[model samples]
Target chain A: MTDKIPVTVLTGYLGAGKTTLLNRILSEPHGKKYAVIVNEFGEIGIDNELIVGADEEVFEMNNGCICCTVRGDLIRIIDGLMRRKGKFDAIIVETTGLADPAPVAQTFFVDEAVGRRTRLDAVVAVADAKWLKDRLKDAPEAKNQIAFADVILVNKTDLVTPEELREIEMRVRAINPYARLHRTQRCSVPLGDVLARNAFDLERILDLEPAFLGSDGGAHHPDHGRDGAHAHHHDGMAHYHDEEIQSVSLRTEEPLDPDKFFPWVQDLVAKDGPSILRCKGILAFQGDPQRFVFQGIHMILDGDHQRPWREDEKRESRIVFIGRNLPEENIRRGFAACQV
Target chain B: MTDADTASLTERTRAIVPGGLVAAVHFLKDTAAFVLGEAALLLAAPNREQRRVAIHDGGILAAACDGQRLVTGGDDGKVMATDAGADSTIVAVDPKRRWIDQVAIGSGAVAWSAGRQVFVKTAKSEERTTDVPSSAGGLAFAPKGFRLAIAHYNGATLWFPNAAAAPERLEWKGSHLAVTFSPDGKFLVTAMQEPMLHGWRLADAKHMRMAGYAAKVRSLDWTADGDWLATGGSNQLILWPFAGKDGPLGKMPRMLAPAQGLAVEVACHPRQPVVAVGFADGLVLLVRLDDGAEIVARRPGAAPVSALAWNATGSLLAFGTEDGEAGIVDLG
Candidate 1:
């Protein structure tokens, strides 16, 4: 896979200054050539000469919900890009506001050719903080764009008060507690946070969620009802939060049986994969020093045993599920029953 | 979803209309044909105008035909064969499930490469396996029928299965993806990881670097006379002349049939000076190499045309696109 190119999917809500961020990524001092793919050639024209206009054709799943669906044009476009293997260093795909990252991420895993030639680096999301919570309540697509992100850039922070900013960050954490969050203005964040993150890599998954497997071993409860408290808080203010999409973190200080863990996770994802946007857990398998790191998007799970736990690191198992209306009790019981 | 847009297709073939992504098309025999891709190897009869799906397992990625039998390698790890009759049988399977990336059928033997191992099965069904230095990037059977050349990282090996000697390796600096010996067996060329192609004279093993392509040379074809090797890389067909012993050395290549889009696939007629090129913009053109004259055979579409092939008699032309839309353009 080293020979394969890395593709970074740039997604954001409409008017979140994605074009400016794309322009910054293109004209940066870094001498890397990127093939920029945009949803459409809109008024904010991508100044890159090697821009490809992508069609937002989302293929729905058999379950009939608007979950993970493959983007046909992306496969075609990426395959065409593979023909010129050495032409560019990386690929940056800009999805439309209505786009779901599930299908975009699935294209890299589902298509044999694309999966073999290119790896999805990370999904960087830019959200307009001033109006993001509003969009979250009114638009399911906005929530998807947030939950599906590997990195969340809460842009337009200047437009909101510090308390409002904190509320947005809290809301973002509520939907996706596992993703890397950043606050910026004019969509300006350190370029390193957006590129070559290897966020989905086995080694980096732990790094992405440093608190995965309770690395800090902090006193955390399974039912962290932080979102419910902030779900609709009005200090004579107009900040209302939606609770349909919230994050549920399950942490246990126990070794788990692989046989029980895999199937339970599989069954849970199978029955609720559409509802579960992202699920990741670093498990301490019975008698195995190495941590088993796995993450899933819908039903597609990619995992393997990673490096042995550091001498000083705790061996607790932490599982994070970010989705809509998840069954926390059954999930907690199921995970707890797997303890050896 | 509206559809994958198998592109606004207007069929010109006898009857078969392949839908999905057409990975390749090859003339199976005199009247039968193999339209590769979502169909795997759909057996097509021109006279009877019947299309039957032959290999039904998975999408076919690599395929080659040897006049009578067609061999295909699929992502399913199965090496299969089918003749004009309709039945397709799996010749072999790699238990490890690696993609059988390259397949070649020539001179009574079928050879396929899965990862670093190359397997050859004779018409009598005798099979032999040889491990190359690395995963085989490309495979081609020598016209003389005694040797098979497997291109890999750092070099191309000319494997003489019957001989006791070690396979001759023409060492190069980079990874070689596509390997082929000239029709006369005097020269062997490889498409490298770089956009250039490196070739060597089989007699002396002299280096001949064919460079300056804007992209890696993926599609290659030799004219019927074996004097020119036409390729797809840039917007035009780059033809390297091999008329003299020097073989495209100290000589500029002949360029023909310039198009607005880059050429992705090219096919040379068996008996004529005509070459058909499929472009990235879905345009297909039949060009007369002698005069650089061209006829717009197929117009541009949503998906790029991926494969182009001509019958041995040079009477039938077949083309397939990435969207699984495939048909034949008859040129009597």
Candidate 2:
């Protein structure tokens, strides 16, 4: 897998310092040449060579927010880059602030030509500490980016008060507590933290955010008081913005029945894939010694059993679903049906 | 195309390297094998003995065969020459480290392009650089002459190695890529960005459109007699006949050996009616252009087979999969 070129997807809202991050990577003297791909509207401010501009494709999906739609031409640009194969060591994709991360990430999984040659290193979302509150309320794209990132950068920390910065961090965590949160000014963060994070690997569980994994780690719950509702008032979540997008983490002490869980999840995604931005689960099945871990972008789901459960580890199921107006009640009921 | 053949292929085909994306396959001599991928090069003797070398630290961008030696360019801005005896040398390296995008070797000379300038390194001179109108999209040397063709945004331009005269420009709209001159030097075809092929008759500059491909044509191979141009992009090999004056004009191309994956590489037999096609699924098929009859060579698994080549005598067929699986098949 290391032989495959690693692609770091940089996503953030408008004026969220995406270009600052891009320029940072370009000038880092890391010796790894990068082919920077910028959206037509989101051209990075850097003047270095090998910058490609791709068309922004945010259209209507009929059932979801108009701002939420798939982008195209990512496969074409990367394939074209492959022609100059040995010249560059990696690829960095900078998307328009209005674009959703699902289509961008899906290109790595869905396209055979691109998927075989390169792997998605990680989706790094830059958040504006000063503007995230308003952006999340008005833009579905802003919310989606936060939900899909494996790493989140709270940029422009200098522009916000300490309490305000804390609120923005909690709000981002509310959307995707699984993503590692970093505070920075002018998108300044160590380059090592952003690149080569094999976030998509099935077995390499990067426990960057232990807070989201809960206190019990497994088998029990440290903070399930919200019943997987993710409504954490106990952790300084000051609900300043009434954003429709929320994170719902469901947990159960009972082992699940695969026959019941698979079909239910499949049907739900089929009916509301766009509405369900990102869904991942660490499931324990009755009579099955292996843990079933699955994650998906919209309708595309990929999962496999990792190593066998250790004797000292806990046996339980935890699922986190992040999206707009998720059916929390139905999900809770559906998971209960899988209990053995 | 059949289950029995697929079953037999999986058992007979041996993987040369344990793992890596096999970028290309070239015959160093009659039996010497060269596979380029992930900046690594593997040379295999006719007896199936192998040696692996890291040619470039980056992806090998372009490759061409020169007698028993192969010249390859990479993103590292280095152009290298490798032969069957394992003699490898850095013939040229761009000072600025721009990606060497295209390369061609023939007539005892090698040509490479970085950005908009084309560089030719011959015996008499270290290298001479000539700037093109646009960033070069493709480069090729005339099979029978010293003229080199460079394709770019507007059209294809022809340059002579020893001449100071202005290049002969072949004009058309849109970007041109993967340029190829018919073996007879009577035609030049460029794969266009619009998933079609645009060609010039070279005699009267008549335009020929080879359209209707499902994707952009990437690989093109002229038959031994220059009668057909076997191409990839379609699920099957689309053989466009060029024996006529118009060159595949007002005629339907023959499609053969349809598969589940796209044909990523195509190699026409040097002396026969057969062609070898490598697909995205890592399957290689030897298909007869006459009837589309297929012989499965490699089963679908591994990475895509990015390159395919036959020896001068057309007896040995060599292939490399993206996952570093490579070997030579004795078809003689």
Candidate 3:
């Protein structure tokens, strides 16, 4: 099988210099023809005008992002681009500011056709240093965006002082320590710093955002204990008023029924609604050692099985939830109940 | 009711349309069914009413309701017509070099525009097609028999469907977003990608321009009486009265703010002259064309509304969102 094309999702709060970063990447001397999927082709009209490439070579999805609703369009576009093969170097999807990145990432996992062609590189989030500090407090999109980033670009350093930038960087690291942090003005950074890195270390994610990694012995899991402590400290931050954005991870050695898993997730989303921003996991079923990846955003849920586990790898199901004031015990119990 | 309760009720109403995927739901006269692009169209109506229609060769780009028939344009570059109620027979299939962008139907003819080409099928037997190098942007049917207006990337063209005469070109250079003819067909309004909205007299082609929107005008709708035109852009809606000196009557008033949501689609009431605005954040608000007072505000979650159309009676409003979900709300 041919190697899957790595899809790097670029997400940030509105006007956080995502387009500026994209323009910088396009203008780089590297002969990489990127297939960019943006919400609106016209909104980035000035950036499009500046990019030096034939219109056909630079593909734009136009209408919307690649989420639950437009995943078909994303798949179709990826399939079409793959047929032309040697035309582009990589696919960079720039999601709308308010979009939850989980659904977009789930596309690469769920569709066999998509999986054969595209693998997720990383979710790069560009955060506004000046406003993000306060936005992380109440804005669910901001918190979720930051929580999902594998590389967090704390952009707009010129807007803040050294001390303020350090504070923002600390906050981002606190929320997501696994993400490589960078501070820049107008998202100006070395392309190598953000690109070509496979930042999705599932094991590291289990350590960093442990709010989603739950355990019965709350004191046993170091990551869980650290997250709980951070949750308390984050409450003191004043900006995060309600803990609207929290991460919790659930792991189980028992096998789970895939059929029951779907409805349980649907119920969880139905009850939580908008507060449930992102949920992703790799499940190890009883009979099948192969991993089952599950992901959902808001009301959209999609999951599928991956390659069988290696002979030496441990078999365990790990699921994480990044959302607002999520009830960890209740979620843990829900997962425990799903075990077959 | 408390505000939270009201908000929850609105959300529940919005949730009637399933989230996460863009699956096409076709409401036939007798059955309501859902169709996934990958799977064959399924009809889940009571009494086992299901039939698969071979309409698309690749995937459907756009499908519109033409009277009682469904007209579809696909990536296959073929425009096919099928009965809306049942898969009885293929009405007509036209092959072309590129995908059909837009289609409009009138008295006895169906007109469609595909990249650089416009074709009109009249009387099911007579077909007239024209090859224009300029790509068409929007297609609209005029009130007169066999009359159609095709908005190209550069300008607009007036054509007779039967090919009785050569098409007349109304030359104005800009990317036109929409071209709408008045109810009486006396005036043609074209909203371009630029800030200017042009109004032209069909008889002499005398035009007037209105400017207020800071961004490209995405949607435009004429009042039922043909006395007012509602143009929306950058989250603001402007009502222009076609009364005074052929130009905009005066300063354009801002009906809604950006905070309310960016207006993406608008539909005028079939009779009462009230306008419905669908916002990018899924807030649907109704405004009176005369005074611009909001009649109703409905927030349908965060899915950007794609299209809005008022039913024939004007009492029911159907709006489609970017998520491929459509909602029918009762006004009365």
Using TM-score as the measure, which candidate wins? 2
lDDT of 1 by residue, B115-223 (tens): 6789888778888778887767789999996689999777898987777787888888656777888999899999764567889999999999998887667888889
TM-score of 3: 0.47
True contacts kept of 3: 0.00
Q: What is the lDDT of residue A80 in candidate 1?
A: 47
Docking quality (DockQ) of candidate 3: 0.02
**Which CAPRI category fits model 2?**
incorrect
Taking candidate 2, what TM-score does its chain B reach relative to the real chain B?
0.93
Report the number of backbone clashes for model 1.
5
| DockQ winner between candidates 2 and 3 | 2
- For model 2, residues B74-162, the per-residue Cα lDDT tens digits are 76889988888778899899886766778888778899987678999876755777888766778988878778999977788999867
Q: lDDT score, residue A207, model 2? A: 48
**Winning model by DockQ:** 2
Worst 10 residues of 1 chain B by lDDT: B1-10
Instruction: Per model, state how many residue pairs clash.
Output: 5, 7, 12
Give the Cα error of residue A230 in candidate 2, in Å. 15
Error of 2 at A161 (Å): 7.6
| Model 3: per-residue Cα lDDT over B1-332, one tens digit each | 24564454345332234332223343444343333232133433334445565565554544445335555655455666555455634434654235455666666567776655787777675777776536565677887766888875456888877666888888675555468787678777787645567667777888667766655576787878777777777565677776444535344544643446667777778799688887778777777655655644466565667566665566556555655565555544
